[model samples]
Structure formats: C-alpha cells, structure tokens
Target: MSPPHAVIAGAGIGGLCSALCLARAGWRVSLYEKAKILEESGAGLQLSPNACAVLRKLGVLERLTPFALAPQAIRIRRARDGATLALMPLNDAEARWGAPYLVVHRADLQRALLDAVAHEGRISLQTDAAVTGFAYGSDGVAVAISRGASRLEATGDCLIGADGLRSFVRQKLSPDDLNFSGRTAWRAVVEADRVPAAMRSEETTLWLGRKAHLVHYPLRQGTIINVVAIVDEDFQPDTDNFWSSHGASKFLEARFSRWDKSARDLLSAAPEWRKWPLADRAPAARLVSGRVALLGDAAHPMLPFLAQGAAQAIEDAGVLAEVLARGQDVEASFRAYQEIRLPRVTRVQKESRRQAVIYHLGGPAAFLRDAAMRALGGETMLARYDWLYRVRESPGQK
Candidate 1:
C-alpha cells in the first residue's frame, strides 16, 4: 500500500520543518510557497531548547550549528538608566532543558530546513506556488495553487496550513481576521564591529523603557547583532501591505531618545530599517476542520516579547508528524493534532502579550517591574519558563 500524502502551504520555517518531519515519517509530501525565490532576509529569531530538541530530532541541528550562536546568558536592564535588573544564566540551560538555547539568523534556519528537504526523496517543493484554497473529501484533499496567471492543483491525504499570519488556508477554515495590535517594531541587523563594545556580548539583552523596549542578540557566529526595538504606537496603513520600509530614521531615533546611549548608537549604526505593525488573533476555539489544520502564525499569532513564535511552530511540526504517522483516520489525526497544540500555543500567546505589557511599562510601574525583577532574581525568572523550555513531549506523542 502507498504511504499517505501530506500537502503543506507556506515555505517558512513552520512549513519547511513540518514537511521535513512528515517526509521522514514515510509520507509523500508537497511543499508550496508564494515567494519567487528563497532569500536570506529577515531578522534573527531565538530557538529555546524546546524548539532545538525538535530540530535535533529532525537531524538539522548539526547543519545549523555552524550558522548559529549559543548565548551564555540573558541580561535584562532598565533602558533609561542602563542599570541591571536581572541576569539569567543560560550556559546551564542545555543541562536543564536537554538542549541548548540558540539564536540564529532567520535565513540560516530556512536554508538548513530547505537543504534537508532537498535530500528527502519523499518531499517535493515548489516556489512561487501560492496556496489559494483546498477541498477535502473522503479519500483526500485537492489543494489549489496559483502560479502567476496559471492555476494548478494537487491531491493529498490532508492539508496543513503552515502559511503565516495572513494565511489563505486559515481564511477558508474560519472567517476570522487577524487584528492589529497598536504597536510598531523596527528590526535591523548590524555588523558586530559597528556595534559598541557593551552591545557586542554573546548574551541576549532586553532593555526595558517606558512604553517601549529593545532586544538585541549576537547572530551568525557573533559576527552580526540582531536588534528589535518596539514601542506602543498607532499605524495607519495607506496601502494593503502591513509591512513597509518607509520608516524615517528620525522617528526611530526620537522614539528611543531617552534610552541608553549604547542602544541609541546601535540604532544609528543600522543604515536601513523596516517597520512592521504587530497583529494577532484571539485564540480560535478550533484550529482544525476535518482534513485541514493550521500551524504557527496562522493558528496563533503572538507578540514577539517571548521569542517563542518560531519555537511553537517547530513543535507543532514534530507533533503533527508523530500523530499522523500512526496511520489512523486522516480527519481524526488532524483533530488530534489541534487538541494537543491549541492549549499550549494559547498559553504562550497570552504570556507573550502579558510580557509585552510588562516590557513597555512606564514611570512607577517601570520601576516596580525592575524592582520585582531584581527580587525575583535572573535565575528565578529563567526558571519560570521551565514550562516552555523543558518539554519532552505533548499529548499523543511518544
């Protein structure tokens, strides 16, 4: 008998990782993307041990290590005064979580997943093939792909929407829309040499300020530093695109005007910057419908405060493959997938938003946040996330 087939939309980390896991599980897979060509762009992302375990299981960790950096610690500070609030030791995070926490360039992770997918005989990947919709029946699913003016379709046992925040598959599954959060972020990467000595440490640092926060970490083997500065503000898009490069340097400079000099220097060093208005949806009561299911940003988009956006998606991929490889009824497998994922991602989503509020606290609240951090201690703060990092398995997974 032939192996079951799985069709996946979106070639981002979530989609690619899911494709790799499923192909390894003896499923014939087809991966689709809307981009014309895969390029090394976008800011860095942190891979806590939870996601690292999945990558190691998928056998891509070795390939990724060359392009990734393992931070020694996570440092939290007051952005205005530059005073230390807490210092969380991460060197021992591996021993605790069973895998090391890694910070990697988004492009590097994508490249690693793409390379692994290429070697797998069970997976076929296509570029510029946008997933328009899918129709499911008793036997399987027929997924529609729009390539330029041509429309093509492929059949599979089930469809997985690893597509991002604006998922076409998600719209078909539910009539919900992603609501924009009243905040904007500036993401940029600069060479290590261009950054100040204080900012070049191999530790991820979070600088908390009034109504804003700054996060920076070493990437690409410490040759580059990824900086993300977010502030509470309103954005009115004149165009349909939620992301655009039309930000003024002066505006960014003014927003962080009261931050520490080191951070401001780093911001000035970034020759170019792009602005993204954060958007998320309230956790859906259902993430699966019959033979279809949503994964990653499509299922639960959250603020970047917790840095588990990609990690949760990678986790989804692993659990999805483990459940479906059982060869149970396809619809039941999808339902099982959602049942295991919804609660976990929902908690992360809520925590991420809560952290955003804490990070952007003002005046007396900001002072209290710092005092509380100092009292809680960095180790304790780090330990608090044990639920997120120390994960061996989810429901229905061995």
Candidate 2:
C-alpha cells in the first residue's frame, strides 16, 4: 500500500516547515503556492529559543547559522535619551534553553527552509497552484486546486491551511477578517557603517518611548542592520498588496522627531522604508474543523510585541507533524494538535498585547515600568520567559 499523502496550501515559512516535518515522518506531501515565482520576502525577525529547537530538529539551523546572528542580549533603552532600562542577557541563551536565540532576516530563514524542502524527495512544491477548495471524506480529502487558467484535483489523507493571515482555506473553515491593531510597523535595513557603532552591535536594541518604540539589530553577519519602528497610530492597510507598501522617510523622521539623537540617527540611516499595519485574528475556538486544519497565522495571528509570531508558527508546524504521523485518524490528530496548541498560543497572544501596552506606556507608568525593569535586571526578566522557551513534548512522544 502507498504511504499516506498530505496536501498543504501556502508555501510560506509555516507551510514549508510543516512540509519538512511531515516528509521526515514518512508522508508524501504536495505543497502549493499562489505566486508563480516563489521568492522569500520580509525584513528581520527574532527567533527565540523555542523556534531554534524545532529548526535544529528539522536540520535547517545549520544552514541558517551562517547568515544569522545570535545576539548576546536585548538592550532596552529609554527613547528620550537612549539610556539603558534593562539588559536581558542572552549570551548564554543556548546553554539555558537548549537552543540559540537567532536574529535573522525573514528572507534568509525562508531560504534555509526552502533549501531543506528541496532535498526531500517526498515533498512536491508547486508554485502558482492555489488550493481553491477541498472535500473531507470519512478517511481523507479531495482538494480543488487552481493554477492560473487551469484546474485540477488532488487527493490526500489530510489538508493543511498554512496559507496565512488572510487564508482562503481559513475562509472556508472559519469566516472572519483580520482586524488592524491601530498601529503601523515600519521596517528598513541600513548598511552597518551608515549608522552609529551602537546600532551595529551584535545585540538587539529596543528603545521604548511614549506611544512608540523601535527595535534594531544586525543581520547577515553584521553587514547590515535591520530597523523596525512601531507607533500607536492608524492606517488602512492594503489587503492585496500590503507588505509592499512603502512609507516616506520624512514622515517616519517626523514621527520620531522627539526621540533621542541616537534613536533618530538610526532612523535617518535607513534610506527607505517598507511598512505594514499590525493586525491579528482573535484566538480561534478551534484550529481544526476536519481533515482541513489551520497552521501559523491562519490559526492564531498575534502582535509582534512578543517576537513569537514566527516562532509560534514554527512551533505549530512541529506539533502538527508529530500528531499526524501517529497514523491515527486525521481529524482526531488535528483535534489533538488543537488541544496541545490552543492554550499556549492564546496566552502568548494575550501577553503580546499586554507587552505592547507596557512598551508604549507614558509618564508615571513608563517610569515605574523602567524602574521595575531595573529592579528585576536581565537575569530575572530572562527567567520569566522560561515557560515560553521550554518545549514539552506530548505525553505519548515522551
């Protein structure tokens, strides 16, 4: 008898990671993408230890380490004068969390996953093919696929909606729009030499101010610096072509006009900026509705304040593969996947939202928050995240 097959929609970070894990577990997989040309895009993202462990298991970490940097710590500063608020030491991250905390360009990480996916004979990735629909039977599913003008059908024991925030598959399962968070994230990459030496350090620097905050870190072996600035503001993000949206440098500088010279210098160093409005879907009641299941942003879209957006997506891929590879019923496995994932992802979502409020605090609140940071220091603050970094396997896997 042929081995069970799985069909996946959206050949993104989550989808690609899921394909790798499933293929490793003895499943034949068909991965589909809506774009004709599959090129990775996006700015920088921090992969906390939770993500690195799974990447190590998938064998993508080795390919990634060369292009990424393991920042020694996260330096939180006051935006008004660039004074340090707290230093969350991460130089010993690997020894403590069982994996390294890597800061990588989104494209580089995607490339690493794509490279691994290419070597797997059991995985078939087809660009320009979109999953238009799917039907779940008692044992498996039949998927409707579209590639430009042509249409075809593919059958598999399971279908995964790793599509993304505005997933077509998610629309079929649970219909809801992703609500904007009344904020905008502006991202840019500057040459390391263009900014002050501090911005080029092998540590992620976060400067927090009233109603705004900025994060900057070095990428690609410290040749370039990735800058991300978030402001409590508003914009109607273009749904169809959002990531490509560009912002004026003057507008960005004006927003940070009151910020410290150090902060403004880093912002000015960025020659151009691409922006996206932050948004999220509320935690779903369930991540699985049938053989069709949600993964990554489709399942739970959360604010980036926690830096777990990508990490959580990577976690979803890891858990989904483990559950399905058991060879049990597909829906049962998906339910098991949901049961394991829902609570954790929901907590991270709530914490991220709360952190956003804390980061943008003003006046007495801001001062107290800073004072608390100083009181706790780096090690204590780092200890608080142990729950998030530690990944416990399912009871059966153990």
Per-residue lDDT of model 1, residues 1-398, tens digit only: 98888999998888999999999889999999999997644679899999999999888998999989999999998888788999999998778988999999988888899889989999999999999978998888999999999999999989999888888899888878677788888888898999878889999999999888889999987888998888898777533676655567899899989888888899999878877888878887888988998999888888888998889999999989988988799888888888888888999999999998889999898888889999999889988989889958554543
Model 2 root mean square deviation, Cα atoms: 1.5
Count of residue pairs whose backbone atoms collide, per candidate: 0, 0
Give the 10-residue window scoring lowest on summed lDDT in candidate 1.
Answer: 237-246
What is the C-alpha lDDT profile of model 2 across 352-376, one tens digit per residue? 9999999999999999999999999
Residue 32 of model 2, lDDT score: 92
The runs of at least 3 residues in candidate 1 whose Cα sits more than 4 Å from the true structure, single-residue gaps closed, are: 394-398
TM-score of 1: 0.97
Local distance difference test, each candidate: 0.88, 0.88
TM-score for candidate 2, please give it: 0.97
- TM-scores for all candidates? 0.97, 0.97
Where's the lowest-lDDT run of ten residues in candidate 2? 389-398
